[model samples]
Target: MDEVEKNKTVEKDMKKLVNKSWFRYWLSAEMSNSYERLQSLSFCYSIIPVLKKLYPNKEEFGEAVKRHLNFFNTEPTWGSPILGIAIAMEEEKAKTKQIPGEAITSLKTGLMGPLAGIGDTIDWGTLKTIIYGIAVTFASSGNILGAFIPLVFTCLTFIIGRYLTNFGYTVGKDSVKSILQQGWIKELIFGTSILGLFMMGALTSNFVKIITPLSFEIAKGQTLVIQEILDSIVPGLLPLCAVFGIYYFLKKGKVNYGVLAIGIVAICLVASFVGVL
Candidate 1:
């Protein structure tokens, strides 16, 4: 009975520790971003409490912290399951001394990239696009509720993150390999990619404004209008081309975003001034 009570107390403390780590991560996941290590410091900061609780020995605690501080970056909300798995593994290591420190490091490095991709697609691309699309519809009609829609989405992210963190804890380390081997994640990525592309296309058509006023005489009392010709061939062709051009430069990874923005504005201004747009 005494051992049972002790186990209960330890379990309670562990839950508290995990919750603290999750809260810290939610608040400051990107706050400590740096070019060199990116989210490493933030990840380390989030799990510090859990590590301290697990490794009471000063040297072990220091080693654990340093182990986590090595080049970690991920999409915080979706990658939160990794945090829970880390905590579970740390607890196992503290108890058994069988799990190598290198194993933990490898787990984080391996999972971060894939989870980041998933998070970016689902959370940033699809979810935000859907939410903001609705918000924009409301805003267009001067509805004050549009402002609160994003707040609701932010809350939903926290809820989803908390649930995923708990899920990782429940699954532990062994199940991750099997889960990754399955088709669900890939299917999810494919579905979300399609939805995101659809949303982006809709947004481009509605918001990206480009038109031409250029015209020339094809014959006596007949004129050829460039914008009309473009419309006849493909509606919103200019805006689509513009979007594709920007996407191309961005994918090349060499263009500075600030410079790109300035160049775009300059082109627009010049086109307007010359009556080509």
Candidate 2:
């Protein structure tokens, strides 16, 4: 009787161990690795079916699920690192006791705010306006090769993310001191962000377009038009002035984007009414 009970207990523990998705362990390692990284190749939902095998019961798997289910929360550019760190932590914890999945909900609530701030100001805030600017300039001039710029940028995101994923995983098993000593995360993230800033500056120079409007005033002798006077000031100055005006309103008035969009429509209508579209 005693032997049978012991065997049953062993089987239960073994089954519990088998029930977890071991791969997610890598995610936990990666998220802790750097402020920015990417690792996911497919939607996290796709992994759920396979993940079922890793947990024998719902309660035992909650923490892992909560942490690993970051598909919608993360951008492709940062997926790998986020998933890797989540997975890595879960696996480490599994060695002793199972973590309740709901714990992830609380953890995420805390981490997401900081991550979002870092991601936006560094990645999208500065990078998007810059790189896309270059892309448009190249594309607009009918330069067929210029279309490749954004595509290349997209591919570059994947490459950077994959590299970070690998780096994080390799270091996951190590102590924090050892990992920090390598300066791998700092070097990669800082170096990349700096490069991103540089790219933004270069792109800004290429992409911004301004067109000015000129008016003509017909002289009493019908020899002069307003376009003659406007041309004397500067070509395209009107358009540049309009842009600055709108920017000032947006900043000073604290107008929301929606309000600004509505204002644009209203201005367009007024311009069309006056034959100034």
Candidate 3:
């Protein structure tokens, strides 16, 4: 085949390999993971279409599949960009046969950590806090808007995932450098982190319920309520203590979440029975 025809065929195959519909499939399936490989299996599955088109031979295709099935785990929403870049790299590798599979794996390994960190901070920490804070306000007032608000806000993540995936494909491997170098992205992350922390504090004070009903007789027909005295010193003090104690326990990593949850329930029940709460 002439160079022109070969180039045309390659372009056509590339177009067929990935599109808007493919991205939707990838986005939906990104979280399909196992305890062992985490997202590695799903990550391979997401790009299977492209890999099939690129590696025509059965042996090459199987190798490609195994190559991608190695260990990988990251936040799905932000990890779309890495998937896109991988697709681009795979395309180049298929056409030129110069890029080793290790290069691709290394790229994924290097990018996953920073991307996951940023993604967790922005998506889980910041966005969730802001959206839930707004939702909780309505929920506390017994308004139904609280339920729908968070659901609507979740759509934004889908949009972001789509955009980042497309952007990664367009920018290719350089996406990592470009994204990390963008001053505005860093600033935005920092700003959102602060806002998220503030929202957490608000939520802690408003929602974490703990109180004391103990009272002591000071004089005839006069009594001092322990809760009232504590409130006079600092409102929500017990709640704050409760929150910090749980945080400390969780941070220690010795206790599993299930155990911690059961402990909290048992403690709460016992405390209520004892009239301490």
The best candidate in terms of lDDT: 1
Which tens-of-lDDT digit does each residue in 1-277 have in candidate 3? 9999998987666655655424644555556665446788778877888888888999989988998887777777786777878887777668667566766776676666567778899889999899989999999999999989998556877778777876777687454345345633344345545544565586577778898889889999999999998999999999989989988997898987678888999999998999988
Candidate 1: where is the Cα deviation over 4 Å? 173-277
lDDT of each: 0.83, 0.48, 0.75
Poorest 10 consecutive residues of model 1 by lDDT? 183-192
Error of 1 at 74 (Å): 1.0
Clashing pairs in 1: none
Compose the digit string of candidate 1's lDDT tens values, residues 1-277: 6999999998889878878888899999999887557898988999999898889999999999999897778899999998998888788778867666766776676677678889999999999899989998998899998888888779878999888887787686455344345634344345545544565586579889999999999899999999999999999999999999999998897997677888899999999999988
- The TM-score ranking, best first, is 1, 3, 2
Local lDDT at 130 for model 2: 77
Question: Could you give the candidate ranking by lDDT, starting with the highest?
Answer: 1, 3, 2
- Positional deviation of 106 in candidate 1, in angstroms? 0.1
1-277: candidate 2 lDDT, tens digit per residue = 6999997985455333322322333233334332112322232442354345445578756644545544223443443444334443344445434333433333333333345456557557667677878889988999886777776665665565565544443444353234335645444345445544454344334554433243444666565445445557865455556666777986796886567778877977777677654
What's each prediction's TM-score? 0.63, 0.40, 0.56
